[model samples]
Target chain A: MTEKLNVFAVRTLTQKEYFAPGHRACQGCAEALAVRLVAKALGRNVIIASATGCMEVVSSPIPFTAWRVPWFHVAFENAAAVASGIESGLKVLMRKGRLPRKKIVTIALAGDGGTADIGLQALSGALERGHDFIYICTDNEAYMNTGIQRSSSTPFGASTTTSPAGKVKMGQITWKKNMPAIAAAHNIPYVATACPSYPIDLVEKVKKAASIEGPAYLHILSVCPTGWRSAPELSIKLGRLAVETGIFPLYEVEHGKYHLSIDFPRLRPIKEYIRLQGRFRHLTEEMIGQIEERVRKEYAELKEKAAKGVAR
Target chain B: MGKRVGMEVSIAAAEAVKQANVDVISAYPITPQTHVVEHLSELVANGELDAEFFCVESEHSALSVCVGSEATGARSFTCTSSQGLALMSEITYIASALRLPIVMIIANRALSAPISIWNDHSDVMSIRDCGWIQFFAENGQDVYDHVFIAYRLAEDRNVLLPAIINMDGFTLSHVIEPIEFIEQEKIDRFLPPYQPVHRLHPDRPVSMGGIALPPIFTETKKAHEVALQGSMPKILETWKAFGDMTGRYYQPVETYKAEDAETIMVIMGSFGETASAAVDLMREEGRSVGLAKIRLWRPFPFEAFKQATLHAKQLVVIDRAISIGGPGGPVASEVKAALYGEPIRPVVYNFVAGLGGRDVSPSDFIKMVDKAEIEIEEGNREGYEIYGVRE
Candidate 1:
């Protein structure tokens, strides 16, 4: 079950910022805001093992850091593996009486490129081993840090630097990799999808994930304004449009049971979401129709799963 | 003193890790390196070693886990052979730079294009510049003893760097040998609980492995180089204290009957023992030949190495790994570089031998020396020959 939060409830939330300000993030980077919300949920009693990506580079420069909690950044593609190690190390140390037995939540943060592509193996390994940690994948569709290169999580019709729109070819021709489905398939204790546009919901989901035992995966749809070639001011509006258009749904899967965070009797048109971003500027009406068809089918399937409820 | 027991060297290496009281052992199984992790898992399973041992997905994740755990102020360890080492080599450099002080045991094996799971120096040679404190073990006993010494040296506040103990695959790992382990009390005294210089704790809240810009990159590297080179004194001090407790002394460059010899052979890893025997055999025949075994490979004992072989006229450097089109062999290149400016230095000759688990016995070492001598007489000085290769 998910709690309904109003603007009044958001005002009551803690004003303390664990992810400090004065770091090098873009003007309207929703991923950075998502990180701040996640950090707020985790508070000071957490250790983060971050993969080399946008947030890692933006937050941690030598001798400077945005993290108020203990954080570690290893090479690309091993955030889950590193988090597994941190969890096991802390567990063993506490058990051996070398450290005080306190609840220290271990979290692994990675971008979509780090999570869906290079880091997939390490993530699967850590999930299979069932380490007590939270894995948060901030999905911005492409490798935005490397100048908008195409990633596996890049949507089928979105144009990137690597998947350039040209005379003979169009944008990314592959469907976005369903990372939440993969995480839920691991039979993990909790798997949720959130967005920074819904700040309270994102924070609540992260808090729930941190409270659960064993492994939890959170896939947050992080909107990149610079990479998407959209106006920086429309970053939150774009995220909301993505969810309302059913291109990126907000839901949670707990123990094989799915719960849709927001239900719509009628979904918004794909043009309202796609026309605002430069990445989809090259798409024709026919291509937009095709994308809309697929989005409708996928959204219907997700709704079916949520209705099935306790089927698993 | 503890009881001397005949055990498989890999198992003994695991026992040494157990005695060191490591907090985490994360490894992936590879040939010749499997038994070490297998025994460690067994120790953890049976409640003999109170450690967290995980068989991770790959060697990359294995070393990544060690780096994470070590950064968390836990004594972490992992072992791998050639392919596994190559897979994890990227993280090895990071671990040392972060100064995690994780101890690793590399079972030396040949790299694969032909894909052979056999003993050679190719694995360790590939990571020559990884910046870890690297050394070779001459035999099973040496491998067993260095585990404690590595932990002591790596965990020292003055020498907070990771270390690698290389032992010949199958030659030292699979064979049973008598190892005399130190008493538990002595080991505890020698290697105290690891006190990390920086750790990821909520109480401390430090950031590790941050990206260094160009302005600060060179300074960080300079500091790392200084830290590695500065660890030599602590390494010597640790060995001296261990020798006082166990009565078996160790050194950077160990020599065998090289004090008055004109011709000396140089080698590393398990071949040192066989080369020593070959030197003795040659000496009995009234020939002037000796052996200089290089124990320390990184922060390479330049002074001790020059002291050992500068007097000899001809130095036969036997390398187990080929450099492939660049130089003759990696070790021979280092030897040449170490002796380049010396006024009294040997005319170094190199031979690549014992490749892909091929047997190079005492006679084989003697034959290599004989070949080097004849080639020197024939004025063939610059190039190296892959010994035992068919035309």
Candidate 2:
């Protein structure tokens, strides 16, 4: 099934603007694409906590702001904590004063490195603390800003600067840490994964997450052209390939059950997804088979769980 | 007029919050601090204190609940120590930044690693720049007196900053001491019910925390700075009013025998009592030594600090914390800077002591003063130095 993105499908943005063009993001960055879509759904009167990462630094250049809404930039791992603070602060201010009483919502934005790595403990603490905030992770896999380094979210068999795919070593031997699964394990209200290519789905998930009280996690598969060694235009194409291969499934964990949101009629070969990105250029046929087998095993387990649906 | 009853300091603090007539008490129990909140909860349960008692799941929630209650125009409080304060720190900073006027009792304890439940300034020190008006009480009764004043200090329309009453964990919190309870009627006469300058009512609207751009951010910070600076005189006035009613005088920087002293030591929080006894012991030994206790850490009392140490030939600033690679404890550094342009600034030397509640003996205070004098006379002038360490 040759599923190239159809250009005829045009998605027009409304007059709503939460995140504006002044944000500091690399050209053709998928995270930027995801932010624009997510913000459009969140609407105004929204407050954001952008954790210290490439997005925060580039968008908020000192005095100037890329966000049209009220935003805060705290340390890398405490976006959730900062948002929690603002939420609570608003409650107090509103209770004793008139400010922060309107139809305001709080959201936390973090990079994959911040969410899956350094900020995990704080995130867990905030969720346990029962803070009403939405946590969004733009998972670009590698730490692209501080020079591309391997992160827990980096996929297996991907070549990072640290995990170079060499003649002797091959590529990344470890699998990506199941962050959405971990977030769901918190028993939070909602947890879902989306791809930048599917902006409507991503925005819809964000709106759903925001509408719910308590903690919610939305993981967006943001492809990095520089890190993935793919053409800028191929970022969205690679994102689609990831979903088609069942390598990065589009699903949501609600309450305690799993529901697969997307289903391909037939699985696309792993070589097609691998061949498009330079990170997977060094995979040998044997390596490819091993990856394929692992992906199949993971998919089987996910399907079994999804089939079970809310089992204790 | 008074009765000497052996009362635990935590109970003393709990009684003080009771006297302050706090409308809501929301807190999670932690070491050394549990007793205070437990007492408050018991008071609430028994109907002795007609207030909301929230047993929050975590310290962060505890503070958040207090913030919520305070915004709703209720006099709110919470108690915690060590990791609890660290957990509340993110919101702790926000509470002050938004000027919630919420008061908290922090039974100060050491931070984790070895995971000590013991007394230390580490946890309180970690949140030094959190914007809360911090105070250190030297004893159980001081804990009682300070809490009454703390509510007044924090709730002042000009101040509008959250206040933290820092007392030693277990050391003072669990220890029993004689405390003369201020009658509830008397407290009522002293503290008016919290009438906030603003409220979260639909009838009126105001922005508490909004998007602050560099151009507009300056105004937000300027407003905060003005409030902090403005709170100084209001705090003094309120303390004076409380002093007139209760016959207890309060100073941002309290002086103990610094008039004709050749040497002086600056200390803060509950450790001031131990330091005071040391100063008395040193003076008995024919040493011209004095002590300065900083009750209000936020306002810094720069002018008062400068004036109190103006006559002293040498100054020993004791820091109960370590700044690691930077300028030692945050206290001594600020003190040194506060005196930088003083016409008669004393020879300021830093001394780090009583960390993790390591005993701060009177002899150590004497030794610190003598060493500072030597550094002063020798003219090997430096901005700051430390005390009570292994040679």
Candidate 3:
């Protein structure tokens, strides 16, 4: 399978100049990487509606612009809604013979704060409408854009501003919100979870999403070195470890079937995952054991769902 | 296209959108604005109009879909009222800033709390500064006509903006009136299909809605404002073209029976006829009163307001919505602001009346006209009276 996949990769051509390399993304910023991959997959015919957060502030700082493709950054909460309006606006303009060029795609980009918190209603409504668009949530676990504050997407045993580690507590009390699962319940054409270390896989998933007829969601786990207090170079190693340790599983939902995209034969222990990240530095052996137990149980459930896919 | 004669207001609005030739319409049923989108959806479904209609999840998506459609450089149209319009509040600002040329119909209705679904100007007035060109219609005919004109104004090269055509909710949205429709071919001649200067297309790429820095951000906003103020000439020109094509004239401020009247009643939206009837009735009773209907609320016709109120001694400004804690009603306050230092202006009296579509009877109009005169005589012109408020 590996030999067949990368064998013809030389012939693969990408769409040109949408989100260019000049963007002000920090090194090892998973969110920016996801954006870069998505842009390549979407081609030059794409337009983006991004919420105001880390990526937007850094990339678009005034007279400077990073996008070769058309990009619109509305408020933090209404990126989805703004993307919806853009989608509708383009359709109408095309119908009236006003559109200069034929091919155009609109997408909304948001951070965990923008998507899981204030923007959830707009996100949910946009998906429910079945609009022909994609919404990508660059989940950095916490609201790193706003100073490492806690967000709903923040996972268990993680130390954030609002979920700081203390004498009586471990780290965060709650587990990460099942955003992809919730989106899956919408019964949209497509829903997937991805991380940036695997660029080609991310691109493939995005291509699959774009081919779908209606709303498709892609939740990307963006690593935040500043927020997670992890080493910059450790980002990829940490991202890979997350999947290997079963902390964050990569999966996709189609029609009604769930399929695991990245599988680990023998999962690594949870202690190895947390010891490198400063956010979970305070975790003890017992806490790691508990996290491991929860991860194993969740992985088992996901495996069962993947097993049920053929019947569906 | 030829002129259509004597049709329902809602039907006329649907006809205008059909004439506007929108490509995608996102709609959900809301009272007063329902028929407009309902009819547009039918046209799209039946191939009467070649279009895509998205029966959206909610008003939020309705506006979102409109934004997406506009950003893609497509001519999109939608109609919503009250709660629906309120729900779309966030996107309304984005639509204008993106300069998508989105045309929307806001059937004026009172927002709920008391939960009434009646005709009123409250909803439209609440979003007064939403960055879209706001227009008011006195009856169904205006709703039908202005929608076509709105598309022309919004899609203009200079004024690439969004516009809202507000007709009185139940009163104008549901009321069938003699509305003259223009032929589609005629509309095509008068208002050409939207020609966007900047399209979000791959061939000749451009960036839209970028984060404008301090150096350029102010200029971006200034561009919108300058376009808004400068759009007056084109707005008048569009109206002239429409009038020339259909023989039905329209103006920002329309005056009637005010040539030599002592008292003038200023109002907006669907209640113009109600004010007109009182003007006629009061004149017979020797009250020397007339009426002035303001059609364009934004890019407000200051010259027209100045001309229409030039001869009046007392002006009764009736507003259907209240602007609590700041001024009386926003319309009354705005009127006062417009006439702040005009040398020969009449003494203005603001009246909050006909809220949430409670009846604005001709009897009440006459009483308001009389009350304005009494307030003028008493030298009391600073405050407002909630008209028909019960003890």
The true-versus-predicted C-alpha distance at residue A12 of model 2, in Å, is 10
Give the best candidate by lDDT.
1
Better of 1 and 3 by lDDT: 1
Question: Lowest-lDDT window of 10 residues in candidate 2 chain B?
Answer: B201-210
User: Model 2, B1-391: lDDT tens per residue?
Assistant: 4345789989888888887877777787898898998889888799788765666557876776576456546788889999999987878877787788888888988898778888878899899878778788878877898887888878877788988888888878988888877777778877778878864433342333333456666777777777777788887888898788677778889989988887888888766888889989988889898888888888678988887888887778888777878876778888889988877778778878887778877788877777777776788666465556669
Per-residue CA lDDT of model 3 for B1-391, tens digit only, reads 4544766688788988888777778877888788888788788878899776777667876877777667666778889999998888877887887787888998888888888798777787777777888899888777877878898888988888899988788788887787766666777876666667876666766666666667787888887788788888988998998888788789989988987888888999877898898888888888788888999998888888988887788788999898778678888888888888788788889899988888998999988877778777888977588999888
Q: Residues B1-391, candidate 1, lDDT per residue (tens digit)?
A: 7899999999999999999999999999999899999999999999999999999999999999999898888899999999999999999999999888999999999999899999999999999999999989999999999999999999999989999999999999999999997889988988888878778999989888888989999999999999999999998998899899999999999999999989999999999888988998999999999999999998899999999999998999999999999779898999999999988778889999999999999999999889899888899876598999877
How many residue-pair clashes does candidate 1 contain?
A: 0
| Steric clash pairs (candidate 1) | none
Residue A218 local lDDT, model 2: 92
Better of 2 and 3 by TM-score: 3
Best by TM-score: 1
Top-scoring candidate (DockQ): 1
* lDDT (Cα, 0-100) at A27 in candidate 3: 71
